[model samples]
Target chain A: MSHHIVEFKNVSFCYPDGTQALKDISFRITHGESVGIIGANGAGKSTLLMHLNGYLMPTSGTVNIGDVYLTKKTQQEIRRKVGIVFQNSDDQLFMPTVYEDVAFGPLNLGLDEAAVRERVDFALNLVNGLELKNKPPHHLSCGQKSAVAIASVIAMEPDILAMDEPAANLDPRSRRLLINLLKTFEHSKIIASHDLDLIMDVCRRCIVVRDGAVAADGPVMEILTDKTLLEENHLELPLSLQR
Target chain B: MTFDTQYYNIGFLDQLSYKDTFVHRLDPRVKLVVTLLFLFTVISFSKYEIFALVPFFLYPVLLMTLGEIPFMFILKKVLLVSPFAVFIGIFNPLLDSGQVFIFNGFTISAGWLSFISILIKFTLTVSTALLLIATTSFPGVCHALRRLKLPAIFVSQLLFLYRYLFVLMEETMRIVRARNMRSFGERGKDMRIYVRLAGTLFLRAVERAERIYHAMLSRGFQGDMPTLKHFQIKSGDVFFALSALALLFVFRFFPATEILGRFVQGVFL
Candidate 1:
């Protein structure tokens, strides 16, 4: 039996404005599983991922990450465990230099200066971005900035990596580079993206969301092969990948 | 698309990479103390003490030349921002009417010289402040402030504000450009449109701040920013402070400018 790294029990959330974003959603992700979350616009995809990182507390029910219940007290521990890379790299790379941004996480974790530097170098090398250490984020290309953003989070050495639209707004070459980089990570990943090709290629399991609920959850091949079900949920399989 | 082009501008030039020569690397506490002393010494002189004040210009000159900043750039920036100071100082001539030495056969009042003194003091103080920023990056200055035990919250806010200033300003400039491209001159300047434009920018900034907070929190930012490296004071910093104080003493007590002027006069006569 697979041990669950994250388990959401009947989780439901409403925005401060009383807008229902997620309704009684329940899911469990196992350790080392690459799960792709697919949904239409306003289908609660981002809301669900935000919960995994403790960015947003559930209005009802409980969220458990590795046996620790997520509350105000445990939010910090949960954040350290689950690193959520936002869609825009601009939000992630806020420091003056790339090295500083990458080192931010480890330094905050109370690691000594030498240890922070080591983690920063290791994280940058993981993304093949050791060359751009001294450069500021504003000076980097979009693809490079995205990689630096990933490095910034990876420096914390989080147990789970939750990425929202990881391949959004990238050229084919940059997208392929990002996918290749993602393939190198052994940590469990939950990727929410509209790029079905990347989803099918990188994720082992796929969860289709519709109207604040999980429409389908199964293996990537099973979901990708079901064209009717995908179209019904406003997600389409790429023509090349369709069989 | 590359954002590098946007980082190259007057603001970036003034804010970064101007060089931290021996003088620039002195402890900010020392520099701040010495700068205040320089200002007080220059301003405490009598109206007829023009010769004494002339030697004081050396401080700014050395800062410019040694710091590797262009003299003309500092001069231009100082002069451009000098009108208000000039206006305030101009009133001194009218307020105090006392006759002094005549220059070029024209009798100059003591009040005029004092007004001139005020102008010189203004230039020295403002230009030195600008040079301080030009030589030291804003972050370096903030770190110095933090080291001096200023309120941590205030210093941290200043650091955050400085870091985001460029980001927010660039965002604002993009919005202004978009507005300009879409509307004519007067239409672009309409109050209603301007208000809406500013409102949108504010909303965007707030949203950006929220996202930034989340990013910071995710990185284990527990209300404090921990630097990966620490700054240490070297022997050069001590030497730089001592030499600067020594120079200030020499210029204050001895009239070097007048001595040089007399030498030139004797040669000419």
Candidate 2:
């Protein structure tokens, strides 16, 4: 009863300033598959994540979410199935209060007050953020901000969850909490991060991005432990793996 | 140093707005509409009419007390904005010296009367506006703006500007801190580098705006911004609005201050 799939075919994106960001990249992710997108800095990992929900339309190819192909007209519809939590929680949590931020997506989906409230409560409760609902985004700690940002997207109930560097700003305890929370989500999750250990804990499969292209695609344990492949991509072995 | 203080000052008003008082509980639309009406009525008085504007002070003072906002906080903000009106009105006595009148047996020019009137109006209008935001949350006002049928784009732009102001300030603070740490006494203090920093900040701000737009789009944003706030114009709202308008009408039409003065004269003489 689920068609939760994200497929990119020969997709390429070129910035208007003549910079080619993502070149001929392609991937297919199925329902409930937790995939990690890893790369060195400026290797187009963010650009590739932007393509997942049709935020930046492919300059060359097509992106399909579930049964629908990504198009300008279908973007609003596609956004419902593919929720992308941006890297900076400040950018994502734009509403004044945590409640308003969590309720933003549901309200935009045209749900009535009761339905929006229910979804917001459910989403915030999932992140253990129900107590922080009335506070503004700027008042929250970075980890709390990150949780509320994810809850904002979760309120939409996207079939596929895509997050960019979700653990980039968290302390060890917060990162551990985030990893545990990610493991509990039933949606098909795609996370982009330099935190390889987090990817190792939460993702079953890993795709290595380098030079705006897929450098490797395989199981997480196999790819992450490949020390030579890690060095080639300017990545170090996960600190835990190295020890 | 001044930047840090200004940042906290902005948050102070927001903190005041979130207080759980009756004034804070009032509908923002009611407060917004009433404040605008108060401004118009206060400003509509003739330039030389100073005494009638005194009653308008009751509106803001009442709000301050009911909203649990400190008087000194509002007074400081009102005074901070007083310089512009003071500068403009200072010339009236020199320019319009004709039409002298007697006040407490002393001769004063109509220009002096108008100058004082301007000051009163400035304090009244500015304090009322400050009181409005002090009692009602900014997003509440934006929601009221949307419900009031103002353009959605404009309201959303305003909302985004407010929501992102702190984010932008934090970014700017980090940029400044990075610059300070890397430079000696004057190496990065040159005006040229500051110009370049402004350019870099502009570019970074543009990139951040794009990210925020993408985040909004991903959340099903389609031109119109919706709110989960359900406003009910309860009995308290109508009672507040009607009583306020009635007081404003009486003050605007009648010489309440002059009548009180004469009545006091009758009692004492």
The list of candidate 1 runs beyond 4 A from truth reads A1-4, B1-8, B14-51, B94-105, B109-111, B263-269
Instruction: Please give, for residues B1-269, the per-residue lDDT of candidate 1 as tens digits.
Output: 13335445456554444355765676666666666677777777775466677777888888788878887877777887899888887877787788776667778777788778778778888887776767766666766777778777887788777667777878878887787789986766788888998899999999999999988888888776666546666787777778878887888888788788899999999
Candidate 2 Cα errors over 4 Å, as ranges: B180-194
Clashing pairs in 1: none
Candidate lDDT (C-alpha), each: 0.82, 0.90
Candidate 2, residue B8: how far the Cα is off, in Å:
0.3
Question: Largest DockQ belongs to which candidate?
Answer: 2
> Looking at model 2, how many pairs of residues clash?
0
Candidate with best lDDT: 2
lDDT of 2 at A51: 82
Query: What is the alpha-carbon lDDT for the whole of candidate 2?
Result: 0.90
Candidate 2 lDDT at B9 equals 90
Q: Tens digit of lDDT per residue, candidate 1, span A1-243?
A: 243388988889999999898888888888999999998999999999989878899999999997789999999989888988999888888876789889989888888888889999999998889999977676788899899999999999998999999888778898999999899888899999989889888999999888888889999999988989989988777667766
Positional deviation of residue B106's Cα in model 1 after best superposition, in angstroms: 3.2
The i-RMS of every model, in angstroms, reads 1.3, 0.9
